[model samples]
Target chain A: MAFAVHRPESMEAVIAALDGTASVAVSGGTLAIRAINEGKSFPLAIVSLRRAGLAGIAQDDGMIEIGAATPIAELVRPDLAFLDGVIASFGAPAVRNMATLGGNLFAPQPYGDFGVALLALDASLAIAGPSGKRRLPLSKFYETGLASNEIVTGIRFAPPAPGTWRWLKATRRALNSAAVIAVAAIIETDRSGTISAVRIALGGVDSHPVRSPVAEAGLLGQVLDSASATKAGEAAATFHPCFTDTYASAWYRRRVLPVFMRRALLGTPLETMP
Target chain B: MKSSYVSFTLNGEEKELLIEPGRRLVDVLREQCGATGTKNGCGQGSCGACTVHIDGVAMLSCLLPAELVDGSEIVTIEGVVRNRVLHVLQEAFLAQAATQCGFCTAGMIMAAKALLDCDPSPSRQAVIEALSGNVCRCTGYEPIIAAVLAAAATLAKRPAAAAAA
Candidate 1:
């Protein structure tokens, strides 16, 4: 049986096409294409986002606006150095060329490094749905899930201050491996070196990426150092329960979450304790 | 649903064909186009044996959808050879024994071609990063990496050779 493909040229066309029976939106197609090929159930029509006028990077007034359908490979600009590093470690070169940022947000757990990074960046998403257009913080979007007829149009975030954003992914290999423990954060200190603000996100340890509220609370108003980072890391582990899988055991992930958390915040090596 | 017509440039020549929706690019290249040079190491996107150049970027043909190829330029392993002569990277692989079972050579050459086309002189880490999508069971990666570097040097000195590639 042949599947119908709808190539829409604008956001309105995409939103209208999505209203068709059993139609779904497809951007980049790295995951959706594979899922269809693997004999998973097919939608009657696919609304391709490639032609939907949603593939560019722009910055205005310190806010970076990225078209949701923009390929991860195109995000290697000098201003996005940390994102470049994250993309390099996200997948192979071929994968990077095809995977889209919007698709990454909806990707299954353990496969969305970009999602984790965006969550920590406190990014907001502009989504177009059957009702109308609306904005949602990445955290709320993840919590509430997307409506079947909604399509993410863009992601907006301000670049974090220099040296304020820290990220680390402990993987099975140096490149393109699934994370054993992935962490990203924006941590700030006051003039006296006390932790003033923190936003931490974790991946690979749960069914979905999550912000570590316990860690943030633990680190607030405390001195930013190895000891405090270790304490916050331990608290972060309590925020989520790990599960056993092919990549790692639940016990192992739980035991190492603190180590990765510390390393993400304090720049400590994985094997060494603070 | 009906099969859609896809017209794209293949190896510098415009080719038109009708393919069913959801048909993978690798299948069309191998079955319909008779371009078996692009092998399918893993039908999933894991192995790079089916790598091809889509719009001057290296991508896994196995992961590409047939409906997405309209108006794009695609080059498989068959396109890598010019004027009945092997490309520099192919010659380097031959001299360095970069192939073991030879299942991955076409994809490796295509990937190397994409990398060199963009950055003629890539560092060792860059070469490794470029080929990270491809996996080979034989010859280890040392010879393949070395072969890519050697081909880069060959292209550096001979501008015509680089132009032909």
Candidate 2:
């Protein structure tokens, strides 16, 4: 049997409550309901983030800070409006509205939209526990996201100097959980239109979001040509596969990782375009 | 349970009521507030039938708690009309033949209205992205999209008239 709900005003009060026996923290409540229905686990108390008034995106000290309760629906609506493609990639607007960034970041399951973009952006995890507020690299937070006691408060990241961001996610049913793979790539080009800096992050093929150092190294300073892009794609297959659930096989995940990497890093070595 | 006082705006009216935190928004809208306009097609957030405008954005009422919106404004299907006259969106949906079974019509209109209000000259892709969350079993969606685009164009051309009405 579940207990009553709790909505705290400050981060301190929320942390104090977490020190109590135990309860489920919910922002949009989309994943909590999904977990209950999927028979994974049931939470006793639901701490809704609504009244906490933690919303919106702010640029602080050159870092992008997104509130814990910022729903995916709103995040998709960038002020510039050129990100409509990236935003549209998430499940129809309903899921986006009800699902949130913090919740998606902390969900134990691998089928999350931010898994790629946040990683590509090199985002950090903001935590508010009894120990007070602390920030962790996004990679470290993924290890603890499965823990019941840890609550992700927000994500912070400094924008890449100047680069192109490409996100590739494969959904079997179009609007369903990605079965095979997802990749987020950010690369900077020189005045000559040659590659200067590059970073690659892959998900759905690892227990945690993994940075493809091999892929990144292969693309850096290489003009990111097609032939070099192929090599970068091949290097991505080196990471371990996140083989859980019926999404896809570990082998299949390995094969698709390269394909996604190659496609995600277009306009390079292929010489097809200058 | 009785001490849970929720104060929020419903259909432009400030409201305060005693309810529990676990009480879902759909239950609150249909049972306590007597606003049956927000339908619950799926208790989960997948279906858009339970959609409502919370702070001028479409949200799945089923996934939210009534207590969560204690200070927020909620716009339901019934709230879209003016003195029994249909909203321009309603007329457009009708003029373009946008409904068949009608399960998704209300939510679709509300979502589209929010998009148009913010960006009156939304592209065809924008209209589709805005309404992608809504599902119409009756394949009458083509006309629905056309109507919203047409209505957006009309409203853009005559913003003063549309607002004055």
Candidate 3:
């Protein structure tokens, strides 16, 4: 089917363009155009966010707000060095120049590695629609997606403390390959080195990114070590059902999730983990 | 579907075309603009054979709609040469035998060109990361990496050579 592309200049214009029509918003086009080329049926119109005034990053009072249309490559700056590992583990440099954080939130399994990291960072989303503007936590947005005519405007989150955020992705190749099992965690400890808070997000094992409460619970009040990481990994493995895809079999993913979870927590290199 | 008129600067020349709905930039460059050097390999974003520069950043042409690039500056492999002379990257590739079937050479060179444009002296690891999206079916990646490093060296010696090309 043929579809006209709309390059609206403002959020209000974009929402109006999407109002009461069979239209979808596209940023970067990495996923949307790929679907179009694969003969996937789409709406009659595509709202392109390229010209929209929705791409930027702003920081205030220890909080960061990234416009929904900002390219993923923008996250690779020196100020945002904490995300270096996540961005590196993502698609290649060219792909990063086009893929956006907002679009990453909608990517399917094995493709939304960035979303998994955001979930661990406890990010929230700003959404605008016909009704008005509203805010939703990233975790809840995963369950109840946007309503008709609603669009994500931006993402807000606070940077995790230094040395607290950890990310790891096991892929067939070192770059440009989908993850076999991607893991992200934010583990904060007190002066005594006991885990005070934890948030764990896993990708590529399910249809969408998911948080592991069981795993988080296992690490609370415990020291971060190989044994605790193993316990947390064991706890996380049972919470979600693994999905098989071209990257790996269901059995293989399930068998390796615990290992990856442990490695992510302990900062173990993939080559030396085994 | 209604067709839209889109205009852009292609390889330093202003180009305007009537584009149909759902038309990709790669198709426009090859069919309408007569710049067939940009190959369409996977049509999906997986293969980087359709790599091109929009506003000086490397992007996959197959994934970009023509309408989105209106009023933008686009550079393809055909634009990399100057006055019948090859760019330093092209010369390095030739000297290193970096191409086999040559299907992926244009995209690979375009990607490398973007890298060199930003980082004049990129390490071998940086070259690999830049071209990770591109796939060379002949598996001639070692020579390609070597050529990019070599080109970087040549450009470093004669920085004006890159600007001239």
Second chain alone, TM-score for each candidate: 0.96, 0.91, 0.97
Candidate 3 lDDT over B118-164, as tens digits, reads: 89899999999999999998956999999999999999899689677
All candidates: TM-score of chain A: 0.95, 0.86, 0.97
Better of 1 and 3 by DockQ: 3
Q: Estimate each model's TM-score.
A: 0.96, 0.85, 0.98
- Judge candidate 1 at residue A141 and give its lDDT: 89
Candidate 3 per-residue lDDT, tens place, A1-274, comes to 3468899999999999998778889999999888888888477898988778889999999999999999999887877898999999899878999999999999989899988999998999999999999999999999999999899989999998889989988888989988888999999989998999999999976778988888899999999888999888777777778788999987788788888888899998767867
- The CAPRI class of candidate 1 is medium
Q: For all the models shown, what interface RMSD does each have?
A: 1.7, 3.0, 1.2
* Higher-ranked by TM-score: 2 or 3: 3
DockQ for each of the predicted structures, in order? 0.64, 0.39, 0.80
Tell how far residue A92 is off in model 1, in angstroms: 0.6
Q: Write the per-residue lDDT of candidate 2 for residues B31-72, one digit (tens) a residue.
A: 999988778786666668888889877788877767777789
Q: At residue A163, what lDDT does model 3 achieve?
A: 90
lDDT score, candidate 1, position A38: 71
Alpha carbon lDDT at A14, candidate 2: 65
Top-lDDT candidate index: 3
lDDT of 3 at A183: 90
